[model samples]
Target: MDVRLGHGGSMFFVRDALRKLTLLSLLFGMAFRAAALVPENVVVLYNSSDPESEEIAQYYRQARGIPEGNLVGLALSQKPQISRDEYNRTIRDPLRKIYEDRQWWELGKNQSGQTLPFVNRRPVLAIIRGVPLKIGGSPLPADFKSDPDDPISKRNEAAVDSELLLLGGLDAPIQGVAPNFYFEGEKRFEDSKLSFMLLISRIDAATVATCKRMIRDAIQIEKTGLWGRAYIDYSNRHQMGTSWLNSIQNECRAQGFATVADRFNQSFPRNYPLSDAALYYGWYDSSVSGPFLNPQFRLRPGSVAIHIHSYSAAQLRDASRNWSAPLLEKGAAATVGNVNEPFLQLTHRLDILNDRLMRGWTWAEASCAALPVSSWQSVALGDPLYRPFHHLDGSGEEIERDRDFRSLVKLARKNSDPGQRLKAIETLAAKQKSGILSEAAGLEALAQGKRGEAQKWFKAALVEYQSADNQIRQYLHLAAIARHAKQTKNAAGILKSGLSRAQSFPNSAALAEWLQIVEPKPKPKPKATSGS
Candidate 1:
């Protein structure tokens, strides 16, 4: 099967099948080229003074089949944040010494007369729970002056993981940010000249148990692939950020991933019916809120949820505080956050991260590629080696084997024509009784301005949907269609019925708000009283 995808003015063909013999050869070639960073190339670092750190490290090593000798322990501060002096003395210097002693890398001088790592044996590092999370209060030398206009250049505080990326080049200045040599690079870490720089990610969360669960979820999900809806919230506050999210939302829809996107000014409201969120990307919130605030809400296992904030990862041990910790507590297997105020331009690009991960890049590789700078604020939390979509290698075997809603949607997208695509999806949805597919078809119709078709699909989806949250979303979609058609009464009726069904649900608040908007009560007559 030859699948053609149209992008801009170009058409790209994806060859999924050929003659049996040729197809077998192609599969072998793809498999040979898909070799990623192996367990042997990873080193697990843990805090020697913290037992939980060692426990998490050992558990991860066993789970990922990493060699036992790869686990390294260092005596480090247990606090979430440490002083610059404490970081250099207890963490940085000690870890560098251990790397040298272990012959992990050989240092050399670059053409610019700066020290660099030319040969590297271990390029991946996993910092476990119990290790200090961020470095605090590192001031530049008094003799060194920085541009007053560039505030980012004057800050020196950093995430411990970010600072460690410069481990191979100790001579590099700590102030401001260092360009990540691997950022947007096509070559794999081991194949690049800057292999000396470590691809670091932390396996830490709000608690030891959550950290362990994250590790387990990553490994398990890699076998089957992460599946479910992608929730993208666009704040419309920044054009660059909004554009990035728009790209991500489009890509998710094209690839048959069920996606719900909010393009409004406000963030997803509290008690929003966000369910089965397998991938979430939103921004500008200081802490976790929205559906995440609902005590019963939890992300799909192995889900990657990221909320861009200056201090998203300021403190990972407190679940109620920043975005990272609370998201982890809510069962997100992987997330990227900033330990401090990383300027918007320097933070991880969510679109790049999603695109890379979908292309089967490891968590560490995707995270590093998305980040434009190192020795800065971002910290990626998850199993560093996790590849959420490793199973979907374009072989078509996985899709055929699973035949699930995600696969069906992917197959339907092979049709480039919008009308044909919707028809294909509707056929598959009916054949499989998939509420997700019905919902996706409705969204596609709505995007094409086919309000009547969209309403039918949404009504079908409402009946097919099993979860109350999903059903409520369908109601909203149907009501919006009715309102757009100037059938206010119809819209009100739909919302009222949905509200009646949603009374016991946490998301009922949204229904009530919509009801007030569509069908407000009339003001009482006061003329008789005035006359008296």
Candidate 2:
């Protein structure tokens, strides 16, 4: 089945719609309380061996208003990777001692009688850039045998950020992943029984400047709200992964976020023009590729872009390698990656991550809640306290400014019948001359096999769209419908027209490439045949 139609699968019934409305009301009615993450609850760790690390820590403290005493610097290796012994000796043990000395956590014992920190005072830890990124080369204890059934469980390699989550329980075996106590907990992090487990995130990137920008961007964008399109690339390789991306697509649309979902085996090609990308979730790419390769490509400020791969966060200082740092370099304020080969199931579940963020959870809260296990490979990067959707909890002017989006959200929530929803959206689009609504209606039409209606809505959207990139996107949609119908000439004509209109846009080059794909230049006529 076509991905477009697949995504637009049957809508909920009236009962489901009412239930969803009740859920939304409850979510919005709950105010952010003291249980929410605060600056006072964060302990900033920096590499005392590196001046830059200290500088970043201080900078973040000032930006987020964390208390100066909360900042702790540790003398440690500046390399991106460190030995597990070095991690335990330099990073883990010393930090634990500090927590103990300050009485940040109350010591207790688990069922195994291993002493650990059970009650927490400060529960969030922000690791600075200069700290080592991951641990390597740590052999298991001599008496410990490898798990025969789970080969991957024997690997002791892990991300330093992930390892810190277990700072309270260092005596526990670190050979296998530990089940996260807060994986899907309904209570807030501070309110949950596992509040002792630290919520750790890294404030590191390829460069100090980028790290500072990430910190500042998160603080600034949270004021107005992060608004724009969501680009979801669904690599239809496995059912589990595909379902996750599919849920993300539905959630984005239901929330009134303009979304583009690609259902191709490979990531979007380099020439694909992706604009206004405030949220990105994709997978299976080893390194950064596609539109991100274009120097002009940049995510909107405070964007949360994530690409799932085994080694996507293998290192943080090199933007040319892996997905996380490159995404940070390209203006994403937050992202998630794995420092080692975290099996597919162990990696961040993007659907859950997106849903949590949308519900106004902090970056750290959302990241941890989405993961099934910790003490493994995942690393949450960016300001741990960032709540990108906090504005959604209020009836602020920012929400009023994007009235079309609000209307669409209402349309989605109030109408469960797919046909009725599309019709109502079309009516609203016409009434308000909203390109966002027109485009959404067009997508819904295409999903229902209404090609002619889709074309009409796309044309209307092309006229109403304000941004050149959005207009170009409408043209591409129209051309795709024509091509699918075997109207090659019509597709070529649409592309040519779009190419002309896009000349002044930054995405013009990408649009031109699309034109070439739809209508390649004819081969030169064979040289005059040799004279007979």
lDDT of 2 by residue, 179-265 (tens): 565676566787765634788889999999999999999998788777777888887766777888988887877676667776646
In order, candidate lDDTs are 0.78, 0.78
Q: TM-scores, in order shown?
A: 0.86, 0.85
After TM-score superposition, what is the CA distance of residue 431 in candidate 2 from its true location, in Å? 2.2
Candidate 1: count the clashes: 0
Q: Runs in model 1 with CA error above 4 Å?
A: 1-36, 112-115, 394-403, 416-419, 480-493, 513-532
